[model samples]
Target: MQVYCTKQHANNGSNRFCTQCGEPLPLAVGQVIDNRYQIIRQLGQGGFGRTYLAEDKNQFHQTCVLKEFAPQVKEPQDLQKAKELFEREANVLKKLQHPQIPRFHTSLQVKLGNKDFFLLVQDYVDGDDYSQLLEQRQSHGKTFSEEEVTTLLRQILPVLSYIHSLDVVHRDISPDNLILRSSDHLPMLIDFGGVKQLPASQGFWFTKLAGNHTLLGKKGYAPEEQLRQGKVYLNSDLYSLAVTILVLLTGKEPQKLYDSYQGLWYWGKEINVSPQLEAVLKKMLAYKPSDRYQTAEQILKNLPLLTATKPPTTHLTKLKTMIVAPGRQRANALVSKFHNKTQAVAKSIPLPVWIRPFAVSLGGTALVVLTGAGTWAVVNAVIRSVTSITIPSISLPEIPQLPNPLGQPVSDKGTKDNTQIISRRQQLEIPEVFFIKMVDELFYTSKPELKGRSLTSKAEDTALRNEWYDVASNFLDKLEQANLSTATRQKLGNYRSQDYEIWRRQARAGQLGNYTISQLNKDTNEKFDRLFPGQQRGKLNQQTFGQIWYAIAADQVSKLKSSN
Candidate 1:
């Protein structure tokens, strides 16, 4: 709420009151000051014109605070003094530079009610005031801890020394006027309304302000000398510091801790200041100004350093720790976590409805479908036969006559030629086993051995086509008698790979030269590991391979999953 806006004066109406201050205050919008500062927001209004958070539009992003005061409001006798005082504060601020001090960027005026009101533009700190800090601590149902009080003292002491070095008596020091940093939470002295810059080491001698002094500082903060109808000294601020610290630690007004009857600070019964620091506070708050720390530098030289930072909120602290720059690294990290690289588990493609009748129901499914009354014997017998068929060792025998290099031409004329070919097929059943072994070779080579050698891996030679099918039969027969269920063997037979490989022999032999690799792949699809053991589910990761795949690396050991 550092931003305060004001309304303009009406034309027809005769309103004596200022549209901004709610009193007969002065100042209006669109009034420029010093021809440099442009009054924007009406920060506050007093008998003196107004205060505004304004800007220098000519400079990019340049912001300055503007305070305007009406000349008529200054009492008749003190009008000149007040104008001089206001200007003096501006001039004093110009020369000051410290972390705790607010800078006076420029000072000028804006016209309001036919009177020129001073507009002082200064820096705007984006932070809370010391009053807000107290309110926060009180809301949490706690007083500032001793460590916290000590830290506040340490941080402000250096600033105080700097201010005093400039020969300026702040004259006013309280919580409402203290500014604090949001990032570090350190306190900074602000609002130099009563700042008086002394000449070198000589402070200006001014009339004692009694009632004004008491209202300006809390009871116990104004040193007795300052209150006894007297002038102020450098120790005045230190006395106020002691009072501020006492209130900070105990969350009580400083006067409450004193026992006037005892003529000294009351301790043990009503106050809780520790003995060591209590001595320090007592000396600081001494009735006579001379007994206290006269300068902020002397006070700090003796006191230990203290630092306190606002502890972060749980969510904010987490945010601070996890902040990541937005760009490629962020994108890549997210993608890496979820990208699908490993192969998916193999799944059985549903056999077309037309093929359902041809499937030999010879396993657990046979029992399931038979419903046990009539088909029970056949189903049970089939299951028994399937389980009983042990895997016989594959002992390769002599190779048979695979079709001749240029076999006998088709027999439209010779019916005897067809019968002779048929007779030969029945006599030599060796091709069935040989074709299966050929697929095994292709599969094995596609793995570890070939690695990335797809180009060299193709078997296009005339001899190799005869050979792929020649070995295919071996893998098939061994799979059939391996105690696998009849349904399992049928499923294997339907595997696009093995069947395609069988059909591919003709295509590979240039019988169907137009056939693509896809056609050959489908014809001889030797997709093994369709029923991988449960433990190896995601290892090979083929959909049809879970409890349904060939034995491979990890899944190969002793875990033979039964066929479906």
Candidate 2:
């Protein structure tokens, strides 16, 4: 049998004191704390207290981390303050709810011999920390690539964003604090001991045993501002993360990667990475907090997509080559030359100008061939090509069966009828020009109220737009609640769904860009003008637009049902 002494050094069960430190050992192996958690082994020890790997007897012997808050303070006031800080950490952990963060179990006081000890329990993350992983890689003469680093950033930045949302700054963020989970290989942020809420005025408390307000982070990893003045911002974590990545990439300490005299990092030439990522890291590691990215979201938005080693040769390029030759004769000659060489090129010719407009309106759901002439074969081929082309930032909703306006019919077997109705009303062959006009009228309208009534301020305009968008969403929700055919429901579901919801929320929060808003306005105005013309346009707000579109859609659905 073995018992861990106060210094966490393993000693024989018969030893009364630590083998190395000579500190008196109290807790023994397999001893239960508070009749709930059974001590298994000591994981680590720090200036404040020790951390243990324990099993919760109450939770089917589940493994958990038990953090002891035994600050080495002699003064009664300092001890009380330490206890307060410990409790505050507990409270902060309780409020944090993120998949990448360790879950806080509970906090309790346990009597070990004559002393009462404070302990906090948290979920035990099962995996190696980045530091250990780096060491392992170093041992094998390997290091993390830029792609792996980017993946790590993507996994952990969201966790930082979540904590920052609650106005909490993780004072300590380094490779040691990030544990890669065995289940998903995603990094899990651990050790909330250095978490401090911003606006410093809101209850200033921390584990400052020396009473000097010294910085609370590992040396060589913490930024200058944090090390010197104990000052930290939301981006301080970003700086630490940059240092950590640099260390991982080079397999060297941060100090080795940086030149203290020049106050600049010398890691660019050391590793081969994309210029875009290099620029992002440089910005993140900026000395001034204001110079760094203001938020995690900003970093995410600016982070470049990983460039592939081999350049992608798209089919569109081949099609363009065949179509855009010197002259019509030359173009036809080039098409002939490649017609047999590349069957794909022959099949992917662009759709006729008239049919192209419909494709845009349907958001690439399905292409309907209205004309049954020689163009039918061309249209089918073009449809296949269009479907193959991946459109960025456009996700088509799943097409659902049209609902029966009448109540569902039950069969003799006491089961609801499973008959599926496909919506053909959408295929009602309106001219390409008429389709565009209808879309314009449905999305926007020129109203007398909006004619000269400009917003007083940007804030006011943003708020008003967000309010109107919500009204529009609510209107759609109401329509969805009504008894409509599955086809009608599916059609309605396609519009004002995910995209509108995201845009509205971002606009309300003032996170959306002016360019996006302008594009939306232009597209919507054209659609609304086509749907409701002149005096029938009514108010230009989202609510009125929503009502108008819904009315027109319901009328169309009614016509289809009556015709059937």
User: How many clashes does the backbone of model 2 have?
Assistant: 21
Residue-wise lDDT of candidate 2 within 16-100, one digit each (tens)? 4466864445444366889888876556665445688787988977778898764433467765766787787788889887767
TM-score of each: 0.46, 0.51
After superposition, candidate 2 runs with Cα above 4 Å error: 1-27, 73-75, 195-214, 307-564
Candidate 1 per-residue C-alpha lDDT over 348-416 given as tens digits, one digit per residue, 9 for 90 to 100: 123333323432233344311100000000000000011100111111111111121112122233112
How much lDDT does each candidate structure score?
A: 0.42, 0.51
Model 1 vs. true fold: TM: 0.46
Badly placed stretches (over 4 Å) of model 1 are 1-50, 73-78, 195-220, 259-263, 304-564
